[model samples]
Target: MMSSCAHPLHGKSVETQHKTAATTSQQEKALADIAAETQTTQPAPVAQNPLLDGLPASDIAGVQADAKRIYSNHWGPVSERSRYVRARILPILKDMGAPRQLEVVPVAESGYNPYAFSPVGATGLWQVMPGTARMLGMNAAKGYDPRRHVEESTRGGVQYLQEMYAMFGNWPTAFAAYHRGPGNMTRRLAQHPWKPQDGLDTMPVPPVTMTYVRGILGLSALVQRGLWTFPEPWETHQVSIEGPIDVNQLAEAAQIDPEELYRFNPGLNHSQYLDSQIVLHVPESMLQPLLANAGQAAPEYVHAKVRKGDNLSVIARRYHTSVHDLKRINPDLSTLLQPGQTLLVPAGHMDSTSPPLNPLLAQGRRIHYRVRNGDNLWNIAKRFGTTPAAIARANSIKSDKTLHPGDRLWLLARARTS
Candidate 1:
């Protein structure tokens, strides 16, 4: 968040945005959730072991590939971020009786940036909307967002996650619920049978939520193998003071540069004092120095969570940044934008006049399919770079209905990339 560009966010940011956790057919998912026709006894999304349990070999392979892709491109910079907050997060999860692997959730959420705020209004490491934050007992009102405080937000996130695990009985579904939102997940679950035989990855979740879960697992696995490393981390240290304190004076007392100080304290919107005795987050090293004078640490990266219709060029222009810079930071970002994906960028002076992206313009393109002789769902799926199940689900194909020459089997509606 730059002094010139950081705009005050106004509402709930959707993760899963575009309130944005949409699966194949929200209508059907909703109907299934309400109808008795949905599956009743689904197997756990992840079996007893969170990592190795219910995922198929092919799915694991896909996750591994994505892990390597994201890791190879993003690990260097983001690793520093994850490592910096490692000390603070590990103890919190451990105290709450959560698996350490689960810690990767925040890393994937916002690159461990407490100042990470989405345009849609999601904030903090968990990327929770204000409504959800308030519901979870965190005050998100102006001048009093506990979500900006790492420790407080971490507790809220952990509690929510623990609850999700209890409800879903597995990590995959729990993680999905975290991103997909519980209600959306419930609706999605209504459509999916707990098929342990097919594995959790095969479940027809929104692509973004599915990716979110896989990345968490991938990071956890990579960490377990000693392949991931973060070093010489610095984190913010908070001190409550009586009345608004001059950021300049505080920065001087803490023996820190003004820019660095501001960087550490995203809560302080200006260099001057304004709040009546707010807690200030300064560098831990600055804490003792700051206390000597009556003080300090800092972490934040400016980023935008990709919306359904956003493209690199569009996102870059909106932030007053160039596409090359975005690509430089996000080397693995696909040409197509997927909701819930986060892309880092320079938080330099933002231009407010930028137009919002229009999903209406990008709404799925139509591709008609008149069945040819000898063609099957599997063959059609392979040709279209999709799945037979996806095509079947899209068309609502009856189990007994068979395809024949000249028969019409429409391909799934999808966002246009090309």
Candidate 2:
């Protein structure tokens, strides 16, 4: 224990320490070299635009591809359509607190054409389906498909999108639901839970949905980045009209080309006559003239004298109107019918089986009336302010039995013209 001389074991221990230190240094240097090589070979992360909101950076490639496609292949027509509708649509989105970029939806769905109808019955600028349109308070019935109305359909589509967003909690998922349907998407999402980090690429949706999502995102991105710009919008104003008016007459009154008027009011293209009261869109410049013409138009309601055995239902059926509408017009009306008591009734047309209430009450300027379903001489004369005998005489009609739909008849002008 007290030996002064270095033992042989001590020298071996020092030599072993030195050899261990040298091996550790060599391993550290090799690790550093490997780290440098790896850094040099790896690609940099892609820079994402903040406006993409819920999309992940991994979607960049697909989004860019779609954006490029739109620019190259769809720019001209898409831009034109976008320019036309942005004025009408953007305000709605703004009022609803929705994203402004939603304007691109019409561009993708219908190229902003109000008349665009899908083979599956999706219609209007937003391409809403008939069932969906009906649920949104649009009249998608046989004679009037309001889904072809630009403002109505856009509101319906945006409301649907908003509902989807509420359900999914994000735009991408909401968009997927919009395409695939809420029920189907809910089922799919139940099977494969959505992960925001992984984005849509990893979602269990069809390729078409994926493409649709990417295209919408791409278009929105382009707008956000100023790579795409909507041109100045055409100015328009709305005029509320009591209708069943001729398109040509309306166009003439507004001093606008009939085709241009049709372009502004494409939803009425199903028939030449606008069959009900509607807020009609027109060029701003034509608004004043249209207003003036509307002022001079015939009254939509006419006075009727309650007669023996006459009831609200009977009168409503006689005029092709409803008791509800009759009550709405005559607020003080009671259930009891008092002969010689007056009530305001809608000056609506009567069908073949129903006789005119008071044919003599018609008093206004003459108009060209196209015979519609269930039209008879008495009802036609009552509608156009002429007597049944006068109509028969002018048109050379032998009897009311000879009248048919699509028959053109000229009614004699009323004694007191407007």
Candidate 3:
């Protein structure tokens, strides 16, 4: 019965074939101390996978055809991040009993920009932006990059999809809400603007957003029937982490490269996962030591367990440190820590005051921009297609209006691009 319950998607979707022992619930949540593990028997989410999960085969067939057309039209450059997203989501879909056809949604959604932002500002490989990331408790700094952590992002994305499903009671409606947000979808529905409240019928939405929801269903169907192939082949894995640590640290501990970690955990960014809890991903045998260490404490780094009412200043003071020092070592410190959480304190480093590193430094280039006489920060920024604050940050200019002609400014587009 347990195996049958787990194989609920058999004969229905390709996602069933993707599930493996690595992503079983027993391993995915194995990060906590032994005592915190639970043995509750919960049904897999296949029945409630999405609104479209219950659609008639005929309807799904139609969606599959439409999705292929749309995806083919908008295909763009394949980004490493997109590849990473595929790697993370495929395993999750299988684990949760989602159909394999679901893979098409990412392919269509990948065209806009590597950092596609909806009007609501969801961002990254999965389009999860800062605001939504915060809502999901993802830290953007301290090198904890959840946006770069594929598993965390996939989990968050799935959770978000599930919430939308609950609200509209259908896959199509939920997809629209996911893009436009429930607030806007509700407003559109109240006005009776486009189609009906029924997502399948399509009452009204921006044409692009409407197409987006349909594409997700359609492409998902195509992938299901094997009518389309994911442009890239992504092998799947199930990984488990054991301790509170940053993604970089986990990469080190796992004996896997940081890029590999980024491939598996797209939700992490330097800030969002400074001292993140244990995360799971595709298991790599080489990372066994790191995986084991991730569940335990490490030396050469201070692991501060957050207590109630502990803010940055309090935490710093308790450790005979300064908030500036704390922020310095934890570059994304601003984003990662919460009360009752744990943080990784680097040895002997405190003070969050280091100048932001040139984002291009990681890629081995020093980006420079020349100041124009008529250019204020905003104008200079607009000319370069960046934010004024970014220009200011690059040049270390205190006054937005202050700039001297011929001053060379570092253009940090690489960071923004990432």
> What lDDT would candidate 1 get against the real structure?
0.56
Per-candidate TM equals 0.54, 0.56, 0.49
Candidate 3: segments with Cα more than 4 A from true spot: 1-65, 73-87, 90-102, 111-121, 139-142, 193-202, 231-389, 392-418
In order, the Cα lDDT scores of the candidates are 0.56, 0.58, 0.49
Which of 2 and 3 is the better model by TM-score?
2
Estimate the Cα RMSD of every predicted model relative to the unseen true structure: 19.5, 24.3, 16.1
Task: Return the top candidate by lDDT.
Answer: 2
Candidate numbers, best lDDT first, in rank order: 2, 1, 3
Clashes of each: 13, 0, 61
lDDT of 3 at 256: 68
User: For residues 1-418, what per-residue lDDT tens digits would candidate 1 score against the true structure?
Assistant: 1001111111121111001112236433532442232134332222222543444444544565567676567777676665445666677777776776666676677776655644333556666655566677764323434555556667778778777767776667777777767777788778875542355557668676666777877676555444555565565676776533455566666667765654454333333333245566666677776667643311112445777788988888777778887888888977878766676665453222211111221133345677767678766655443467767877888634678987776664321110
Residue 157 CA error for candidate 3 (Å)? 1.8
> Predicted candidate 3: what Cα RMSD to the true structure?
16.1
* lDDT assessment of candidate 3: 0.49
